[model samples]
Target chain A: MNGFKIIVLAKQVPDTRNVGKDAMKEDGTVNRAALPAIFNPEDLNALEQALRIKEAHPGSTLTILTMGPGRAADIIREALFRGADDGFLLTDRAFAGSDTLATSYALAKAIEKIGRPDLIVCGRQAIDGDTAQVGPQVAEKLGFPQITYAEEVNIEGDVVRVKRRLERGIEIVKASLPLLITVNGSAPECRPRNARMVMRYKKATTLTERQSANEDYLRMYTSHPYLNIEEIGFKDLDANIDDCGLAGSPTKVKKIENVVFQAKESMVMPATDHHLDALMKELIINHTLG
Target chain B: MNNIFVYCEVEGGVIADVSLELCTKGRKLADQLHCQLEAVVIGANLSGVEKQLYPYGVDVVNIADDPRLEPYTTLPHTSVMIQLIREEQPQIALMGATTIGRDLGPRVSSALHSGLTADCTSLEIGDHEDKKNEKVYKDLLYQIRPAFGGNIIATIVNPDCRPQMATVREGVMKKEILSKHYVGTVKNLEVSRYVNDSDFVVSVIERHMEKSKVNLKGSSIVITGGYGVGSREGFDQLFELASVIGAEVGASRAAVDAGFADHDRQIGQTGVTVRPKLYIAFGVSGQVQHVAGMQESSMIISVNNDPKAPINAIADYVIQGDVNDVVPKMIKYYKKNTK
Candidate 1:
């Protein structure tokens, strides 16, 4: 019932929505240069849940923690525009190509450095990987319980009640404090940026971004420390280099292939099902069901 | 080489559909690896259900029955599976990519210091070579899946880890019953003894059933929209067209991400995989992830302003017009025709 410290985990992903023909290279790897980077869709859903909890608990503080390149600081600014107190960008070359395991390890180290939080909210999965492993893995590494596919959450006494969306139906569950919950895309959609907050924090920059900024803006970020989003690297979290990125990942991608199903296997039909009776019977006979 | 183990999940006293699909795939993989195809079911009082395994190509079935395991919390299931895999040392283990499997697979694999590939669509037994490193790992579990939202396919291999694991989505493979052969064996286990009360950190307080208004799986005609639907009002036109064609309304991940529709109605990877007799897309440009789930529909019709949308490639009929402009016309024409 009291105010609690909350951390929201977000990611900056390629805007695959506007995928072009050249989205992938001959090697099957993503052509990062061609696509624009945007906030992961579900992570915005996660931040909305965190914002909801913060709204209910008046004095609660919500912080954004994301692990990506320095440009990932954009997500922090995005979060701040929607009412987050602070954020940290876990960036460094060492964190590249990290599978869920290594990604969780580095994130867990970052979480530990931030100290104990009453709740940790993350999206069910990132659009890029679609693994859904990092959330539970961080809970395992942190020795805290986790609730996945959470549709709704609320505070009751010291226990956080969560309604989980399972394949069959919904189940309401309860757990103690210091728990992690992965928000589903089914959760409430996030609010658009507030015009006032956007105008206020539009000048926010990280130390890395400041390197490319003009002198006047650098002086402004220094004068208003809040304008400088905190940036942490591998050394800051004390993460082992062996367990931070590609080196720590166990799974290896051996090959990539392009696939396009043949339309010739299917028949072209007009919008009107004028031959409805015949089509239905044919589908039934073919075991497509009546 | 060791046997391949498929963990069967039971719901409402019946085996899940994905489990049976696992048996079909496991049997093929087992034969390729020269080992037996084994299955393990964890639930309460699942005595007669072991009979269902042999018909699905399982040569051996193991049941860990416990009343506490009925609804399935994370720890009790993970404990039994970890113990079972350690004892059998199966070279490959598989589970469905359901809510339970996704939560449990990562924990189990991490605890065992192995690797897990989630949402794999294809599995094969073959050699994996790191072409860049010039190293070849022979006879590995070739775990193949859609990466970067199905734009590309990546075949992964956990060469050094024992018991390579994967969680496959339902309906990815057709399930078939193999005739009872060679009198299969069954073993009842007492795995509940290993689980403690502390293991269940989060307990179910209540259960609520929110059956969707439209069952996308059972509907014969499906009308799907994508981000191109634009807004919530745009999605209303989609429902109007669905009502005219007697089709269930569905959305692509794009629409769901755009907050124009609910998640359950989203048709694609991480959402429901639907194979209706007729699938119509309105203003929907199909992403690879969305196409992976709905490409099997009998008659696919795509409507979009852009002629080169990916969904257009797989569509049987392509209409190059904005969905907003076209859907209302379809509704008016259908209303004029015979009911």
Candidate 2:
């Protein structure tokens, strides 16, 4: 059996899970600068699945493809440090404010540009949006079958078996080659970065970054061609400008507001046995509790 | 006809609660827009399924009963839904935000070039003014949901899309029967016409779908823990207290993610929306997402060391203490006060 060509889609998202007091602006918008940017957690799980497949296939190669600002290349490097062979950064001003559908269109176009692979794996959803729509939408755009909420994936010959973690149960399904899989967060966490891999790919930079690189780094890029991460922008793809970004997105945000609760004049009570007994007695008498 | 269409999910020959909940909401939206409410159920042995839907004020029920359709596969379901939606030209389309709906909604929306919002907390019929386009659109479906990790609420609209699509999680909307005597027409679909042979490429090899054991929504009193609970053993105290008081145990996403509780026990914007008579929080520094689920509780009592915990703002009783200390005391007093 030949090794499969696999691509893992990843995102660099703000750590919204541990949002701090400074995480939100006074105007109710996310303060991106205050939040630390890291590789989306589920996407890392997807990367782990991709890496496992690569290890199993011996000659297989895993590529990371991410769409965001130039800084998103950080996650690509992060993936390379964890055993990916190479990566591509899809960035352009045209892709700003893209909803799930438009983002899928742009990613599908980039995938085509990278040449269709045997399998495409990505997290079920991005933390920031939590839509869980991109993976299936991309599969639909590329005319491939999708297996979502996959906790485990194994390939035998041209057939791929996936174990999906549904809300209430588990299911094992099988499909042929050329498929897309959206891994659930319940999947195994990604392996830690290898020291050797990090030393080798630490200087990996996209063309945009290369232009802004120091002289010594520029010379190293010439010597080590692999360090030059491929950068794909709007000009490189045949995607219609209208269908690649905010213009192509059908959903529009009409308004955004900070979550505010109607505050109750709460009766503060000390954590004393007396207060506890009284509270319980009061609840029992009022039939609020027994 | 430009009616409201809900893509009902069926499992084990029964319509999912989320789908019925959407039907209830859809019926309301249909009434507001003065359009018929329609339901599309695709699965095996769906005979007389419309009987279950009509009481929700559904005007029409579309059934595609095929053996291969049960145990949903993405391609076939998407094909059936897309073809049906295109033919009906519904002004609005809604679905459950379960694993099946999250998978199928995007594909169908992508194929039709329509927009889809997932896990919407609220749906409303309203008008939108596109100031840039200088256009006023009436009766647009407003898809309201918490975004950016549930710190903010956003109202989304698809002004130009033919069928505005949105997916709501189970229990987010109330399920009410309009009338038991309500009647609806049934339209049986020829499954082969909408789905192709290639659509069955993915085959289910094995399946074990157990009914969810947790009954958070049905519980009258809920005792919940957050990450501050410290460890899984820390949650044992909560369970002990719940058993003594005849209450159900719930957890915030943080606690569940920390492995203190199972995902099914999660309560938040992404999890179950519960409105119990009494909600007691232990060590919960509430994020808006968590509060969104339980704020409707008739009485909220928060126990935490942090006096400024966001949950305390909405809590009717703010008990300043640690769960480790307060939980045992509450359990002791409950036993003492009871017969």
Candidate 3:
């Protein structure tokens, strides 16, 4: 039972749950190729809870990391076609427009240059910044200990247990290891893609995607360096080009509006359910949940 | 020396209605920053929530309590909110985007380097700019929200942080309560040496409560669903029409990622924004992250067999139909018109 070095953190957003009419662009921005980036559905439910705590410990080791741009190495080769043994992209141009405190300070300095690990798991928000606030600001910038919406994590020996998902119910905590979790889209639904690990890590890539492939996919990712999915920019960590991204973000967006509430006159019913249960007891006896 | 704190959130001994709607929106940002609105209250027998947080216009209430600050453990509520924002330097703090303020507002805004703003639906005090020295920062807090998916309304502003934090969302603002008692002063925050006992490394091992406090974020009636309520026994007949109409079911992050409900019964821009008074969207085909979390529900009623469902133009009652044959005929016509 040895195995507990996970990492997860994935992102590559867009696919704003499929919005259209070219999902906004008259000055507000996000027309990110009319949506379709994927792999941020609660970071694939936090990479299936770090592949179920690396299949209940046993030489454990999941990985992933991401940051975005450099086409977020397509969510680090979709977390190595769902099993992840390697992944890290962090991308560059000084982390571009960060926010979420410079994306948790370039992911807590790329999890301290991808070193500290005993679990990190992510995804409590990132449907293009719904702001669950970067895994509790990357567990308060790596001083660790974060459990968040989690939904079943287990481990039990050096502590972990989790189960979170709360908005009024369900909670169970434990925490201890080099912790940090987030998960929840009601966690547990990330398993497909092991057609033999997709014909063995379907060309892993990300050396800027093997320098734009071709030439027999650059001699099979330079003779399979675990098919090379590692692209660390911001000078490979220790980052601090002003704390890494929109000059180390501190919130800021002043005005945007575009809201559309409107509907003040709506009385169209008739599919009958006794007039929708008598207008739900006449709006709960007129306290009008407003 | 301006103020306005409000992290109240007591939970089941009373206090969280989004911390009395962020103290009635921190008593109008503490009467537009003339100062004094406080309210802290960490846990452990959060003693008489200062008379239920002084008619919600507080004026100062603090109260850390103890027994290891009962229940909420985020290293003792982020070291008692980073030592109450560094010994009350609060210019504006606020929380209640629940789940213990999204896990204690970004660890007390990253241990007070400050700048939070998550889920906020509006806060305002105004004056922002400093987009790299375009300088402005006058009485800031703006914070606003709903971006890109609820399609715009951004606002945000931390203009060089200093407790100008935020969180909001829980029926976005308005829980009013100042009919009297703004005569504050309650204090009591010792917090045993800023927490120890290995910061109570996560404790509460069982609190299954979903038993009739039936609050889907203060539900007055909410039947949510979507992904065409197509399975998981169509959300157990939309929770048998939310228990024959006492109501509260909510979902849609495509029926909670197609497992058909339970990311704490999700309900929108990353779940839970509800304003229910009667929301009822079955087979819910309304997205704008589930209609920006129940578009201030005061009567929505959708149903959806897709008559071009965009929650039928902000539904006030648009039943086109088929939530597994209209939610068992609206739960057999509400148990035969309620006895």
Candidate 4:
């Protein structure tokens, strides 16, 4: 089997999981600035999966691509430090407030510029929106097969076998080449950055475009030109205007509300195995679960 | 005007509990909007699903029951849902945020070029005076969910789309009860799209059920230890106490990192969000992210030597002593009480 090229899609999002007292906005939307910006957790899991595949196939190259503001370059650097072969930062002023559809378009264009990849991996969903739509939508835009909630992935010849986590049990699915996988948090944790790789590639590439590198720093990335960051723009990918932004998005938000569930909550149950069985039966009988 | 539609998810030839929850909720929203509530059931052998929806207050049940829909695939499911939405033109649609709902909702919303809100905690009816269909067009659906983690709540509304869509999280809303002698209209339909073999890249060979004893998310009494628990031995005390109570043992994110417990048992933003009835926190300083998950518990008891620990703020009962000392006493008390 030939060594495959893989790309991991990552996003830099506000850590919405830890909203504090100052997290609210005056008008009730989320005060995003109050939250810390971090790399999407599942995306790191996706990167781990990609790195495992690369390890399985020795010569395989793993690439990281992200679309965000300039600070997103930090995630790219983190990816490089972690042994990714290449990185691309798709940053542009035009890409803002892009829902899944528009976000996928930009990512798909960036993926196209990177050339054909055997596997395109992404986190199942970003925590901020929790939409879980971008990975499948990107695959749709690129006209490829998508396997979501992939807990485990294995490649057998030309076929890609994956364990997709469903509601009741696990579904073992097999697809042909050139597929997209959206990894769940259940995937194995990512390996720490290699010490040697970190020393060698700390300044191995120029990504921000705005940064000025010193001579010693410039010498580090000069050896492997392939490791250099490729920043693609809207014009480079030639994305369709109607399919790229708010104009292409059909979903509209009419109103936003804050819900405080003031329920009369109480439970009547004895804490024992027998009591638990009876409680389970009660819940099942009440149709809460079965 | 077209009525509100609820995507009744069925697995193993039975309607999912969340679908009933949505139908019940959708019934209220429809009534608030002054529209009829309709149930849309799409799956294989979905014969008895319509009758079940009636008790939940569905006026009409649309069925797209087919052999191809027997085992769920994205292609067939998305095609069926898109076809139904186009034909019925439902003003509002709701689905549970289960595996199937999460998979199918986005695809259908994308194909229809509409906005969809996922994992919503609340749903509301909005009144918009756009001169379209006056009744249906004037009605809006507001999807409310906790944003920026669970720190703040956000209400999002999609007004322009014909069918307002939302995939609600499981356990967030209450499921409706089914009464006897319930009846509703069921209309069976076929898969309308020309789905080619080329479109589907993957084929499901088999389903394997991996039975795991521990599911911290659904446990009633969750005993979680944190970094302050000191070592794996400290977490073992928590597990012992949990076993005494016939409960599941969980860990804070720090405990999982410290190898004190498995990742599956970790409760927080990065792990499972549990709303257990009785949450016993041992040596855990409550982080905001961790609190987001357990804040809704019926009762919280904290055991930490630090009197001013953040966990004390949220805990209903605070034990100002070392968990190593306090946990054993609690276990003894529990044993004595139970006996």
Residue pairs that clash (backbone atoms under 3 angstroms), model 3: A3-A60, B231-B234
When summed lDDT is taken over every stretch of 10 residues in candidate 3 chain B, the lowest stretch is B330-339
Which candidate order results from sorting by lDDT in descending order? Answer: 2, 1, 3, 4
Error of 4 at A280 (Å): 24
Instruction: Give the Cα error of residue A39 in candidate 2, in Å.
Output: 0.6
- Candidate 2: stretches off by over 4 Å: none
Encode model 1's per-residue lDDT on A161-220: one tens digit a residue. Answer: 999988768899988888989998788989999899898888887898889778888788
Displacement of the residue B243 alpha carbon in candidate 1, Å:
6.5
Candidate with best TM-score: 2
Put down candidate 3 lDDT per residue, A108-198, tens digits, no spaces: 8988998989779888887767778888888878888888888788887887788786765787877678888888777787887778776
Ten consecutive residues with minimal summed lDDT in candidate 1 chain B?
B330-339
lDDT tens digits by residue: candidate 4, A121-193: 9999997777898887787777777889998999877888899876457898888779989998877987888
Better of 2 and 4 by TM-score: 2
Using Cα atoms with residue i matched to residue i, what is each candidate's TM-score against the true structure?
0.86, 0.98, 0.33, 0.80
State the lDDT of candidate 3 residue by residue for B212-323, as single tens digits: 3446876678888878777788788788768766778878877676677656677775567787667888877665556777788777878887777667788877877677
The models' CA-based lDDT, in order, is: 0.83, 0.93, 0.77, 0.74
Clashing pairs in 2: none
True contacts kept of each: 0.56, 0.91, 0.66, 0.41
Lowest lDDT block of 10, candidate 1 chain A: A268-277
Error of 4 at B24 (Å): 1.6
Of 1 and 2, the candidate ahead on DockQ is 2
